[model samples]
Structures are given as C-alpha cells and as structure tokens.
Target: MRKIACSLLLAGTLVFGMANSDVEASTHTVKNGESLWNISKSSKVSITNLKKWNNLTSDSLYPNQILQTSAKKTNSASNGISAKKGTFKTKSNVNVRSAAGTTNKVVAKVKKGTTLTVSQQKKLGNDVWFHVKVNKTSGWILSSLLTSANKSTSKSSTASQNVVDQAMKLRFIPYLFGGTTKNGFDCSGFVQYAFKQSGKKISRTTLSQFAQSKKVTSPKPGDLVFFKNTYRKGISHVGIYIGNNKFVHAGGKQSQVTSLSNSYWKSKFDSFKRL
Candidate 1:
C-alpha cells in the first residue's frame, strides 16, 4: 500500500509539472521601435528560440506582430557562449562599440559598477567582447571589462536597422574631408561607417561606390542615393536613403538628414543604387 501511494504521488506531481510548464508558454505582441534583439534580451529568450517558436526566417520584425515569448523548453540560453549564464557587470569604465571590433563606432560608454544584461559574446583576437545592454542602450564591451554573474540570457539588431542606427547616432558630427572615423566624416566616409556597423564592408569613395552598385529605379530604404556635381562633377556625393524621401549624409559642414525631394538635392539626383 505504501509503495502504491508513493507511485500515485509521483504521477500527480508529474501531471502538475506538465500543466505548469504549459502556463509558462506565453505570447508577445511586438511594439513599435522594438526588434527581435530587444524582445529576446528583455524576455531572456534567445533570438534563435524566438525565431523557432514564431517560425521567423529572418531578423525582421514588425509592430503588432505576434510572437511566442515563452515555451515549455527552448534554446533561449544556448547562445553559444561557454559562460554558465549571461548576466554581467562592468569591471571598469568601458566604451561599448557597435560591433565586436575596436574600429567599430562607439555607441555608449558604460561606467564602472554598472550592471549589464548580456546578449552574447564573441572572440575577437585573444579577447572576448560581450554584446550587452545597459538601460535602453546596447553594444559590445570587452569581456575583460565585465564580470559574468551566470544569471542571464542574448539578441542582436538586424543588419538594415544597424546601418540606420549607426548613421543616426552620428547625425551631428562635423564633416571632415577624406575622413572615415566617428570623429568626423566625408560623404562617402559616413556611408562606409554606417554599413560597417552592420558588418558590411563598402567602397570608400563616392565614385567607386557608384561604380560598384547596381542601379535601382525605385529606391527603397537602405539604398544609396547618389548625387552628381555636388562639389565636383559626377558621383561626388552619396547619402543613405532612409525612406519618406529623406536621406542622411555628411555634407558640407556636418552630418545631417535632408530631403531627397528638396530642390538642391532633387536637381543633383543621379540615381539610386544598392550595395
């Protein structure tokens, strides 16, 4: 009788556990200005699991899109990092960059003692950099400057968004002739930096850039809009097309967002191209 009672108790506990697991599986309706990267980090679910659950083939996500935020079991924590978990804290004042390399644009500076939510880590040379979030900002910080707490989980921004985000971050930087760094930019230099933030390498000059790309008649967001005879003749200026007939570039004095439909730009419009 004792043995039978014990067996019945175990079976009941298993049934309860199964029910509880089902309750944990929940849905998330994506909100505006949110991406799979943002949602995955906040929900502690891996981007891989989020895609798997919702049957997403790409990192593209739309506002009001319904997604599976939870499940009975998921690879949410399997972010390929060997660390026991993803939670971490800054060891010092660390400059977080857009990508894993030091050459990438600095996105944020996390002061010492700040807590960070890690999304993933990548080995760059002999050092590892943790892709982390602090407050609402996300970027990569050297792992040596972080102490993992082994308590959390990770997601990354999509390529197109990354390009736009990087460009937007430098909206007010001064234009420097033949410059390519975040400190300053020329027209083509600005374009190069923006794409590099998304892990895409592009030509360094406006003319070479024009030569490399295939022309597109109907320009889309993320395409390159070229201008002829801005300062010189033929493909001297380029800007990123960001929809709504507006584009961003490092023009005469500084990096600024302008309208493609504006009289000055409209007159010089050569063609739109995609790299």
Candidate 2:
C-alpha cells in the first residue's frame, strides 16, 4: 500500500522533481505527519514525477495502498538550474495551467490548493510576469500578479446568474454552433455566452468546461450538464438542466427548454455539474 506525503500538511506546500518516476506504492500505512515530498524523497523520487506516475494534482494521501504510476520521461530535467518558483491561487473551481508561451492550448488543469512550479522568469523591469510552466512548455505571465498559494481569496463567478438571465431573455433563441450573439448558438457556445452575460470567464469547449467542475448526481437550476452518444464518449452537447426534469439549451434552430427526463436527453445524458 502507498504511504501518504507528510509535506502536504504545510498549507499547500510541495517539493517534487520534473522527472523521477521509478516509484513503488508505499509499503506501509501512512501516519498523521507525512508530507508528499518526504515520502517521495525517502523513496528517491520527485513529487512531479510522482504526480506524473499517479496522475495526481491535488495533494492528500492515504496509507496501505499501491499507487498508479508511470515511467519518468527520458528527456525530463533534474539538475537544479537557477530558477524562481512562485504560486497562483485558484480563482475558480478549476484553473488552467497553459504552456508557458501560448495564446491558446491548455497544458494542464490545476485544481484548488495545489502548488504550481515556476522557473526562469521574464521580468518587466523588476515586475513579475506569468513566465512559468504547468506540465510542459514555457510562457509569459505577470509574476507579481500570480497570487501566492497561501492567499485564500477566490475569483468570483456569475455563471449561474448569467445563465438564468440569458435563458429568460432569450427563451425563444435558437441553438447554433459558434454563434455568440443572441441569434443562434451551439451547445457549448450557448453556455459560454450565457455565462459571459452573467460575468464568468469560461472556455469555448464543452469537455474543457466539464472538466472545470466536479460532477453531481442531481443538477441545480443553473447547473451546466452535458450529454453524449451522438458524437463522442464523454459528452457532445450541453444544457442547463433546471429543476423539475427540465433544461434550456440551444439546439436545432433555436434555444429551447427540455426535460432531463425526456427519452432522447436521458439516453444521451452524461452528467451534470458545477464550474
């Protein structure tokens, strides 16, 4: 069984390497005071590598269990080059850590309470920028702007408000793909535009948005649930499944409200969740 990491007790602290994946599940049960870094270090592995092997981002470990891990990347770096590491508190339920240098293309998703690593930064005359790496790739970001992990402040989201308002105002609007205006909209686009109206920063992709929140067995009024079986495995369409087995979504030619208990939606439904 895998042992727990003691370093995790340090209020969102982690010490891991870029590539050291020859990990074995902990043999003993994890006790109260163990940090993930301590366990990895004692086992001669790095935390990053441990995460890579086990696919873990948020920290908290248990005792007496084998961990799922993968082999370390051959080209991964290890030698400590002069680098600066900072933290970014999650403003939303799910935060994206993109390649250090891309206008688009998310590298990985960092959940709340996880410490992100930073390296050689690009400063603007004594100012910090977003020059850090998530899983791979480097990019520019305001270093000073990236809040410390210790900060407890949260980024506000009005997704629920906007969603409800849009549904009410455009109760008759049709659904279309790539349509942002009130004219027509696609499954994901409808949700995006509605949330935008409500003042929430959301992605364009449905699956990406779905990954932003944890799933729920039952949905709330403004919850954005997804459906599939018509295109992909996880989900292909989206809607705001309101209370009483009903939902509002942009589909066919107009944004329409339907029932979650309907045969078509029920069969195609994947899951409902928050963001």
Candidate 3:
C-alpha cells in the first residue's frame, strides 16, 4: 500500500469518527469543509482515480453526499489499488499509523465506528496488518481488529455506539451558539459535529435538518430527535439519540448527555428523523 502524505497530521489534530461499512464499494461521505483536491491528498487516491471511481464529471460535493472512494468489488480489488479488498469496521478506537508496524509514526486516531477500505493485507508474524483508508486518510490497521462490513444490523449498531463513544470524548466542551468544532457547539452544531466525527454528514441547521430527514415513528439510537420552540417558535434544537430514551446535545452551558424522558425535553419533543 502506498503511504498517504503524513504532513497533514502536523498541521492539526485530525479527528476521524465516521463509521460506514459497504461491501459493494468503498465510499466516503463528504464533510462540511472537504474539497475534491483535499480528499485526493488525504486518501492518496489521485483526483483522476477518485473521479473514475465515483463517476464525477465535475468537482462538486456537498455535505452528507456519499462518494465512492474505490470501485465496486468484483471478486477482487478492482480499484487497481489494493490486492485483497473489503470494507472493514474498526473493532475499537484505533490509531492509524504511517506504516504497517508500530515503529511507524501515528498519523491519526480513528474512532470505533470508523470504516476502512482494505487495499492490501499483510501478515507479519503474529500481527496481521491491513493497509486501509479511513475517509480521506489512508493508513494501516491491524486485521484482527476488523470485521467484514456486510452485516447491516451489526453495522448500524456499531455505528451508533461509535457515535456515542465519540460524542462523549468531547464532554464539557463549552456551548457556543453557532460553534461546530471541538472547542464548542450549539444544539444543532453539536449534533452535526458528532455525526461528522462518526463519518456521516447532515444539514447544518435544525430547520434544514428537520426538513431533510425522513420522519420515523420510533427513533433508533443515533437518530436525530429534534425539539420545537426551545428558544424560538418552531424547530430549534436537535440531539443524537443514545438509546434508553437519552441523547447528547449542547445545552445550557455545555455539551452533555440528557434524558429524552426529562420533563423539559419531553414536553418540547417535536419528532424523530432518520438520516
């Protein structure tokens, strides 16, 4: 597997928390600030290769849009990149290293729900290594720590759990009215941020998000449960469901996990939507 440029790691603390597992194709959900060239630089896949894989005539991308990063598998790695191919979900929070071994420098820390595209599989003594791509970043992860991405039940469950795990990592980040970064977050901003970290993209504002999603009678964990008239007349707040009738959101003074059954939220409950 070719090495993706590690220089970006020095530029900032890269946070990868998205989880998607598709056996048919290796795909990436474009984030808020990503561009085609940036994706090329990170995945180490040439712009030409990316376009060919996704069948793009122009360099246009929007948040929540899923783009195929590698071609659909046809009995082998058809992308001309890896030898052995499959979509793999990280079994745990893992470090993506610059090389296949621990002696290599750490490039980024990928969260549990993070999905990887395995291009090459290598066995070095007791440690089996897989050269993989996590969103825009490509690196090596241990093979034993991955499971095939073909199980929808396991995939969704793993994804939701990973989303919760990643959200909790930012505990106590102060609430910022319009903030969407790790530094701070508003209600909707926190929801977007959490999903983005988990490798999924959603609309930025509560109203847009509420309008964009499909309403569901019952919410699954990780579904967006919005609230109306929190500070305004209509839908104004959103949070990520975390099972047990609980969700995590940026509320009051900071980001936190709270109960959906809580009197305040329960009274303001608007609807649930699956994205």
Q: Output the number of the lDDT-best candidate.
A: 1
* Model 3, runs deviating above 4 Å: 1-150
Q: What TM-score would every model get versus the actual structure?
A: 0.43, 0.42, 0.45
| Order of the predicted models by TM-score, top scorer first | 3, 1, 2
- Measured with C-alpha atoms, the lDDT of residue 250 in candidate 2 is 81
Residue 108 lDDT, candidate 2, scale 0-100: 47
Instruction: List the RMSD of every prediction in angstroms.
Output: 17.8, 18.9, 22.4
Candidate 2 deviant stretches above 4 angstroms: 1-162
Question: Model 1: runs farther than 4 Å from truth?
Answer: 1-157
Candidate 3 lDDT score relative to the true structure = 0.77
Better of 1 and 3 by lDDT: 1
lDDT per residue (tens digit) for residues 1-275 in model 3 = 12334555533333322223334236666899899998888666789988765535467666765666664532234433336788888889999875567876676798887778887765666787888887676667878888888586677888888788878777799999889998889888888888889998888998998988889988888788899988999898988888888988899899988998799999999998888
Ranking by lDDT: 1, 3, 2
For candidate 1, give the lDDT of residue 205. Answer: 93
Candidate 2 or 1, higher TM-score: 1
lDDT of 1 by residue, 1-275 (tens): 99999999999999999887665546677899999999988888899988766545468666666677876433435323433236787878889875567886676788887888776676767888777778866667888888755432222224555677788888989999998998999999999999988789998999899998989998767788999987888778999988788999999699999997789999999999987
